[model samples]
Target: MIVMNDSQYHQLVDDAFERIEQTMDSDDFDIECDINGGVLTLEFENRSKMVINKQEPLHQLWLATKFGGYHFEWHEAEQQWICNRSGNEFWSLLVESITKQSGEELSF
Candidate 1:
């Protein structure tokens, strides 16, 4: 597990959101994330009901919505998100989203 300070965690979250926005073609969509209360909340404008939270103890993060629930694992060595217990594709989407938004490639 790669241990990061609070600042690094915040940066990762910001980078992830940037990627998500870039991947979306719709102009009416917006995502807001908050990292407080030992959790990270991702809120979407178009789909208000679609919200995701990443809680502390960081290894065990839970994602929930109308679709289903996902339990994620963070691979620090790979700097990737893993969801073998659910849809693994989400990690890619997030990465793509950040990349698209930043218009830059991520080394991790």
Candidate 2:
């Protein structure tokens, strides 16, 4: 597992949001990522729901938010991400490192 600092994880999440802002023409969306729990919650303007399943490929989890409510998964062996839900090979905006937080990175 690749352990990452909190700042790095937050940077990844922020980047995902930036991608959405650039690609979508609709209202802005918000993403709340909790690295310790390995979960990302995306709230859309029109109340659309998109859940990313990152359970498999144990070492890491990658999720990318896009237009038209599509989801993608990361292929570790291929070193690439795929949109299994849409049957296409694509990119992932999710930047996942190791789940553990360093002593200073964790805020109680």
Assess the local accuracy of residue 104 in candidate 1 as a C-alpha lDDT between 0 and 100: 35
Model 2 worst lDDT run, 10 consecutive residues: 97-106
> Per-residue CA lDDT of candidate 2, range 1-108, in tens?
244455654454455444533543242324232323445444343344333434433323345344333444445466444555655543322222111111111111
Q: Which stretches of candidate 2 lie over 4 Å from their true place?
A: 1-36, 57-78, 84-87, 90-108
TM-score of each: 0.49, 0.33
lDDT of 1 by residue, 17-88 (tens): 455445443343355555554454455554343344555456444555555567665667767666757447
For this target, which candidate reaches the highest lDDT against the unseen true structure?
1
Q: Pairs clashing in candidate 2? A: none
